[model samples]
Target: MMFEPFQRLTSRTIVLSQENIDTDQIIPARFLTTTSKEGLGQSVFFDWRYNTEGRLRNDSPLDGFAPSEFEILVAGPNFGCGSSREHAPWALSDFGFRAVVSSDIADIFKSNALKNGLLPVEVDKKTHQQLMKTPGAEVTIDLESQTVRIGHDWQTVFEVEAFARRCLLDGVDPLGHLIKQLPTIEAYERRRDEL
Candidate 1:
């Protein structure tokens, strides 16, 4: 599927102020049985979202954002810092998070997220603090300029790899981007055969 290109996103924030939120915590090992991403959202952060009785926790940020669709998740430093499981990003995307803003993100998780149409926007510590300071604040992410605008007066630049940025802006996954270049690839192959 051609993932929709990300340009500008304006949404309320859900603060997940936990550091080193590994893939297992994001989506436990037990929930990884499905080949399909469908229904994974329900299991995203399964342990934290539910209590011992399998009830939704009253104070969980997932609970607060569940009723409403919050596009941005402002997480603590070293977000997604566990095993390199593609399922983590799948679960987050399935959960309807468009972007994850943090001070840092694990390399593998960041790559997976970009491939799956989830923007991992990294900002400075100060910016992260500001975001957490105001829960439910409206945040704007501009992919074109690679900037995250917190409020009317506060804006911070975030870095994304050039190729990944292009993919996101074009609304195409990496595979889709390669497929679009099939004609060029074919021509190059034919030229090599002519030699």
Candidate 2:
């Protein structure tokens, strides 16, 4: 899937300062029935967003905020830590989150997120703490510089895999990246056949 090209993003953040937020908490296992990525946004954080009767909880943390208003999710440590479910990132991306910021993100989740065009930004402990404390702060994520900056004073660097960064900058998934090389691949094949 070709995602929106992520060169730089400047947006208000939504802070979910709960550690060990696993994939199930992101998108419950029951909602994983369909292969489609569409409409998963409604079910993202389904358990926390609704009651047993399926009504929106008045006291829910997300009650007052709009997903479109907050594109970056500042999560607590060990975010996306449970099963290696790609659906976690799928639901997040579908919910209009372009990036997830944390002190530490689970490895598999990071990989899944990158492939799906959801940037997982791993920053230092102090930076994460600062972000957690400041809810709804406007931040800038510059994918080219691998930096996250909050206002004129605070800024931090994060790391992502090189190839994944390239793909994200180009707005292509791994498959899409490979598909772009088709002309060269066909030329190589033709040469091999001639030889």
Candidate 3:
């Protein structure tokens, strides 16, 4: 998992439907068994996003940028819908998505993102409307203050959970975070042993 706290970024983004989109749809059921997170990027949004040969054709909005290159996806409300699998964000972050902006996010998905150090930004309906209209608009996610800016024209402020914020800030992937705090943890263990 890649943890990028202050990612100064630009990209062409697509705003999509707010429906029962889930992990299976995000990366397809075929890839679910894979243990490594790297190649799952190719399968992202498989069923609805690509043709049988897995080619990104002109019909879809995401086609503007090559699948390997696209960085942002502005989605509708209730995104990350369906089963709670960490693989959803795994594919996204592995696929190089720095941030995902939506009207509302599923709680489990948000937590999964935090564990992997992916930024899931939630904005109100008005901001969602503006971003949806911003075809191929580039988005900037400033983790220091948790703000998302589209081009030089508009910006949106968001709220992330405080503990999650600290983890993201220091580039702490979940595993790395636990290991980094291990000294204190070890001390606690030693005290407990004494008890």
**lDDT at 77, model 1:** 85
Query: lDDT tens string, model 1, 1-195?
Result: 667889999998889898888889999999877878777888899998899899988678877646345889899888998888888989888888989999999999999999888899999999999997887889999999999998798999999999999988988777876788999999999999999
N/CA/C clash count, model 2: 0
What tens-digit string does per-residue lDDT give for candidate 2 at 27-67?
A: 99999899787888889999999999999885755666777
Compared with the true structure, all predictions reach lDDT values of 0.88, 0.91, 0.75
**TM-score, cand. 1:** 0.88
Using all chains and alpha carbons, the TM-scores for the candidates as numbered come to: 0.88, 0.88, 0.80
> 1 or 3, which is superior by TM-score?
1
Clashing pairs in 2: none
Worst 10 residues of 2 by lDDT: 58-67
Q: Which candidate comes out best when scored by lDDT?
A: 2
- lDDT by residue (tens digit), candidate 3, 76-127: 7777877788889988877777678888888888888777766788998888
Structure candidate 3, residue pairs in collision? 26-45
User: Candidate 3: deviation at residue 85, Å?
Assistant: 1.6
lDDT of 1 at 143: 94
